[model samples]
Target: MNPLYQIFVDPFVQMAGAPDLFAQTIWEGFVGGMLYALIALGYVLIFKASGVFNFAQGIMMVFAALTLVGLHEMGVHAYIALLLTLGVMYLLAVGVERAVLRPLVNQPDIILFMATFGLTYLLIGAGELVFGGNPKTMIAKELGLPSGGIDFNILGGLVSLQRIDIAAAVIASILVAGLAAFFQYTRVGRALRAVADDHQAALSVGISLNEIWVVVWFAAGVVALATGVMWGARSNVSFALQIVALKALPVLILGGFTSVPGAIVGGLVVGIGEKLGEFYWGPLLGGGIESWLAYVIALAFLLFRPHGLFGEKIIERI
Candidate 1:
């Protein structure tokens, strides 16, 4: 009856004896992880185009969800409302390009980062003013999304799984795959990569930096829409949900800022690691340790591998 053994060893032993619970835990992790990657990808899109980190991605998710709900309330059918939302995002992108990126071309990285912070607050104010700062139920069934449960019997026990979560996993996987392929194979994707490498170089080659920024930001808007819908489908759409998007920071840390596959792998690692850690090792530190476990992992990773699990290190010679 060692207290140390009881805290760590016994819990894992208990987990070993419960296969269904383990599967359920893993399922939860995968779903949460994918959502993190989705948000991180939004950041990646912005960073790739402008070489600046965007802090407003979380609010973009909130704004996208709010727009969908607002459109739905205004008598637009879900499909048309979604299309309209895309248009809204598209307009927002174009406006940002014309007003922000065009003016800030060749600005310092810190200035661009500050600009994104301003954009974040602008979005928050806009979303609150427009959406009323209330949590709204997701248009799950109305949007033709599925809802049900799966039953698994293991170790003489039962585990229930949500069908919506399954759909989220598949959709997330397809999204990541499509994005990877697009970036790897398409002309626009190559343009995006070139832009990421060097804005001046791309511009020298007759590439329009403003145009690429607009396109990339619009693409991020599309991602925000998709992420918002799935997220809203799981819970009420609100500013609070935007807070969850902050989890992408840790994912970014774990996966490296510039690596797409790193985002996915890092998200999954953080998601699963935090969940498992909370369940097994968290109690030893009291309880409810899930709130900041990802950060702790990120800090540890930073100490050991500052570039992140998949990030590349660059040496700049002055």
Candidate 2:
């Protein structure tokens, strides 16, 4: 057996030999991919309304999780904490509208983007100051989420999948579907699409830019909350998971910035592609290649389709 043949071709043969591994990997990929798409949802909403790239979306996810956990530590019941977090998010939406969006209403787009970068630092500091900068275990039992595993037995071996992972996948599907329907069928959604095209034209039509901005950012906060919940269920809730939200940036790159459907599709592609590449080719690169593989795919997409899979081509006549 030639070493090159074994190194290069063996995995394909092995994949055919063990279909179960492939199935398991794809399942894991889909769940993780949906989580990434959830974060992308927040980015898309904010970008669509005000054209500000909300760099704080990930930190918002962290802040939401910290709000939930901090309430629990204060002896509040989980359900109450959950409801209170919703209220906090609403207040956050209002504050952002009054404090940030209002003053910067007519500023250049780059300035608005920088403002969000500042908001990111603000959220990080606030979350750490309130939550003590330590990882906290998700109160899965307290929340009454499922805590069982499903087992697949084949050839005298068992591979088990957690029920909570299944639940998270189901919830993500619902969120994505609901978001798509809103943007397609609802009045506010239509207004958001209008604003995404041209803020001045939207305003000319009597669309309230401030109102829409608040609504869109609140929608983003809801997405952040839902995402924090599911990811928290998987591991300890911490600020670190927010960095994983940053992974959604490449997803946004592959998907059009304003496309809900593209987020779903691009997230699945990145998730499954990275997992497959790492499993099959990681040893060749000394392993740990999955960390940067998503960016590699995004770079390839940039070279081929800078506007992304669903983005419209920008035609500038100079």
Candidate 3:
């Protein structure tokens, strides 16, 4: 077998020989991509309203998941723990607006960006202080998530689909749709759009910047919680999970920071690309290429598009 042929053609031949495996791989990638989209959506919400590229979103997801799981461990009911976690996130939004954004209003974008990094460190310290820096199991059974998976026979092979992954996909779809509806039709949504367009102009038109900031942060928090739950169900919730947020960097680059639809599409592209590349071509490179493949894909797209696939093109007037 030619080395190049083994690297390039063998994977496809294997895929062609086992259609079921290909389908399974695709499904796995799709689920992974949806999770990436969820995280990217959090970034979009914050960026749109405040022009702050929040670096703390990954921490927020872990923190939220930890809070819920911690509460349940302390003997609180699952649903009650969930409600309490939401309350915590809401309060956190209010606190951030008052303590961070309000004081830093009108500052340079770099300053605001730095503030989120500070916030990230603060959350990390606080979460560790409270939660003891331990990995906790997600209360999937308590939360009523489906366990086990369904198996299907295709192309003379068994393709097993995890019920939880299916649920994650469905929940992600619903959340994205819900957010779309909220942004398109609600008065607050219109104000949010205005704020995203121009903060000073939004204030001139009677939109309260403070209120908008709080709402945006709160919305991002809610997104973080949902992401946390889904992710925790898939694996143990730990500080290490915060690394997943880094995956969103390529996603944002691929989708553009401001477009929600771009997040979804970019995530799927990155997810599927990484999986296929890892499964097929990974061994040639001695494996473990999944970590960086998505970035390569994003960089490839960046060379051509610059702003991203769905990102708005900027026209500079001299």
Best-performing candidate as measured by lDDT: 3
Task: Please list the residue runs of candidate 3 whose C-alpha ends up more than 4 Å from where it truly belongs after superposition.
Answer: none
> What range of 10 consecutive residues in model 2 has the weakest lDDT sum?
153-162
lDDT of 2 by residue, 1-318 (tens): 777986779878867777778777777888888888889889988887787889999989889988988898899999999899999998999999899889988899889889988888888898888788899888777877898899998634566688988888888889878887888899999998888889999999999988888888889999999889889889878989977887999999899887777888888888888888888778777999888899999889989998888866889898
Estimated TM-score per prediction? 0.96, 0.94, 0.98
lDDT for each residue of candidate 1 in 1-318, tens digit (9 for 90 to 100): 789798758988978888778878887888888888888888877876787788878888889989999989989998898899999999999988887778987789899888888988999999999879889877878788789998878657787888888888888888888887888899988998899898788989988877888888988888888889889888889988878888889999888888888888888988888888887788778978888999999889989888888887867798
Regions of candidate 2 where Cα sits further than 4 Å from its true position: 1-8, 154-157
The whole-model C-alpha lDDT of candidate 1 against the native structure comes to 0.86
Give the RMSD in angstroms, all C-alphas superposed, for model 3: 1.0
lDDT of each residue in 1-318, candidate 3, tens digit only: 799899768999999998988998898999999999999999999998899999999999999999999999999999999999999999999999999999998899899999999999999999999989989999999998998999998778999999999999999999999999999999999999999998889999899999989899988998999999999999989999999889988999999988999999998998888888988789889999999999999999999999999998988999
Off by over 4 Å in 1: 1-3
How far in Å is the alpha carbon of 276 misplaced in model 2?
1.4
Model 2, C-alpha of 214: deviation from truth (Å): 0.5
